[model samples]
Target: MRFVLKHPEQADVEKIESLDSVKGTFTQAGQFQVIIGNDVDLFYNDFADVSGIEGTSKETVKDLAKSNQNALQRLMSNLAEIFSPLIPALITGGLILGFRNILEGVQIQMLGQKIVDGALAFTQNGAPIYNTIVDVSQFWSGVNHFLWLIGEAIFHFLPVGITWSITRKMGTTQILGIVLGITLVSPQLMNAYGVAGAESINTWNFGFAEVQMIGYQAQVLPAMMAGFVLVYLERFFKKVIPNAVSMVFVPLLSIIPAVLVAHVILGPIGWTIGAWISDVVYAGLTSQLRVLFAAIFGFFYSPLVITGLHHMTNAIDLQLTADFGGTLLWPMIAFSNIAQGSAVLGIYLLHRGDKKEEQVSIPAIISAYLGVTEPAMFGINMKYRYPFIAAMIGSSIAAVVSVGLGLMANSIGVGGLPGFLSFNADRWLLFGLIALIAMVVPATLTYMYGKRVEGNE
Candidate 1:
């Protein structure tokens, strides 16, 4: 307000045609004027440059001037849009990771973790660094931990939180955010096991479930429930309150009330959702109908990877670590993607191109091998279409076969060479071999097929 009033004269006045402003008197040589529309025309000769402001208010200026309010408003608007999807993504990943951490003990056991005592002695230096690194990693790993917490808090606790910010109907994505974030962060909670006797030396503790299932509620469910309120709050406030005012007011009023509801109600709801999804997927993947089931999962899975929905699998893994003790999904994508990349790239290898085509093919193939889909997708698979179909067919074959092998993943992260982690040597080796086989087949096929198209002889 002060900024607008102090420099009113310096701003060149614009005379946009007056609206029905009989009461609001224009006393001067109409020293100032206001126009409300897409474009403002300054009648005065003094007006030389065009300027814009963000907020709508009646401030008289001698010349058109860009106002800080407008800049700040635009910045806030841009940030909001950028963060909307990101908030959900962050929460879903964080919660799932939290859950995965909690269930690591059971997960480690299910994968038959061993050799910890034999691998290396956890003496003072080793012990401290190991613990410190793990803890520090957790802190840095989920910088979005708090953000997702906000995401969750709004979704589960504040109906207004969810409705105010977003208009879209809540569905798998919304639920998945709660599901995944719970999966990750829930696993991080304190899990203490009650040993049977004083001399039970082998008992281990998990972060969330301390030797029991009921305790999963204590740590994992709060954030899960928090997901609902935020979703609601988003819709409610977004309409009634201006974004600037809502920024401060939303957190203060929304957070406290939503948090209260979380502790009281939403925890069990989230747990149920997480458990149900995991159960259904595991049941499908493990059935005697594995081939059909796997092909279906495989077909959609890579598409998800292509679009980034594959992050849901990350949530599933976190839940896996917590509920059933391990994960087997995503490892297939590692093979399929690599295979697609290799096969498509084989075109470049077999190419006797006009240099330019070969150049394009080589880079596309390399990017695919590196597990980036765009160069392969937008570059080759998309351009030729056949290569993509070939890659998909190859991926499905590999996926079904991987399922048949009962391949499971104990290690985390997306598909790449590093995904070969020997943490569970038997499963790792079996899956690794299977993945290698899968990739080789498709790559060979693409290479052979691509040979005809290249060099035009």
Candidate 2:
């Protein structure tokens, strides 16, 4: 006799060939599985003599849950691997721009002329602008201009790095990835930044259709989608096409179609999706309910990091930076990082005498303060459940303050104590205030909570 198990919610029946197969599908729909027959042992002789079938079922469910969790962790790990190499370049660019902002945007008064004596001067909007570092020092002015070359290469050509990195991660053709990325941001195309105000965009007129000659500078989604498309195409071609001529035709076929698909279809779709997400997030940040939203987001952000969903914020931040002059979301992320670090610091203080705990907590605290929170989160905070809660509470309060005050960052930068360098010079004081809150609240709460928990124990 064949047995069938019906899922109550899904209303789908699964055919059970044996007890082993049923165990495999035990957790498919829900936590519990029921077998309704006195002849259950007849299905499997090995399980017939087993006395603890209920316990075995529970173990199977736990194993399935663990397997699913491992799968998710692997997915998140791969996603992080794609962007991990780009961090150094992004940080370097952010710091360079921050220094440039100090040089060019800051104003000082000297000798009663609103500037240094005999310095180079310029007029903007009919007002004489002066007293800036670049305005005063010729050497610094040259350095400022030089730094822009590196900055532009980092930000403007970011898609190239992303695509190349994707190909590297996916084990596809890296050279083809570089070529595909270049086509998206070619100088011959109209700059993506100027698309807003321009009266007309250049196009390629091919008798039947005209393709817009637009670039995808600083875009994240288009490059990523296009890179994967290229990877699959290369794989497909290599499988079918004989090895005798695979080298020449595989890359050629893979790149050309991928490029065409990117420009003609995927690029616009990706752009629209990215823009829509940015608009929704921007609306929330600027809306009347922004504080509430920030509170919820801040509290859950560390948890999101644990699940690896926090990686999506990179795309959103890049889109916000492309659409608006700056991103308001990243500063909140920085606050969360600080809050988690502070929680770990509290743990460190409580376990100062224990060398084993000190070895884990010290590095975790430093790593969290430097914008990477997995160490603190998993090693210390998550291990001590109360500390994680304390960090979340602290992050929520700091995020509320950040959104309420309208703090904005010029770009995504270091997300720890040094994160203030990424914010606008005008908002530095406000960022500092929130950073202090992020630190103090989590540490104080964790310390208090830890003491109570220890006392109870």
TM-scores for all candidates? 0.52, 0.81
Per-residue lDDT of model 1, residues 1-457, tens digit only: 1123344556532221123211011111122223221223322211333334433333233122224235544333332332344344433443344343443312222333233545632555554213222233466446535454653443223222222223223321343344323432333432212222334333235555333222232222334346556556545655678877976764555555554455335645666787787788788778888778878776666556443445456446545545654555666666666766766666566655645455445665666655555556544565566677667777787788888877766424445444554124445567667767767776777777777665465
In model 2, the runs with Cα more than 4 Å from the true position are 1-75, 110-130
Instruction: Write model 2 residue lDDT over 1-457, tens digit each, in one string.
Output: 1222233446233453133333212222123333323444564454545743332453344334334445766566566678878889988988888888877777756512343356645576656654677776899999999999998898889889988998998889999999999999999989999998999998989889999988999888888889899999999999999999998999999999999999999999888888899999999999999999999999999888866778778878888988887788999999999999999999888778976566667877888988988768766687678999999999999999999988988888988989988865777888888999999999999998899889999
Of the candidates shown, which would achieve the greatest TM-score relative to the real structure? 2
RMSD of candidates 1 onward, in order: 17.3, 11.3
Let me know the TM-score candidate 2 reaches against the reference structure: 0.81
Error of model 1, residue 227, in angstroms? 3.2
Count: clashes, candidate 1: 67
Model 1: residue 363 alpha-carbon error in angstroms: 3.4
- The prediction achieving the highest lDDT against the true structure is 2
| CA lDDT, every model vs. true structure | 0.49, 0.81
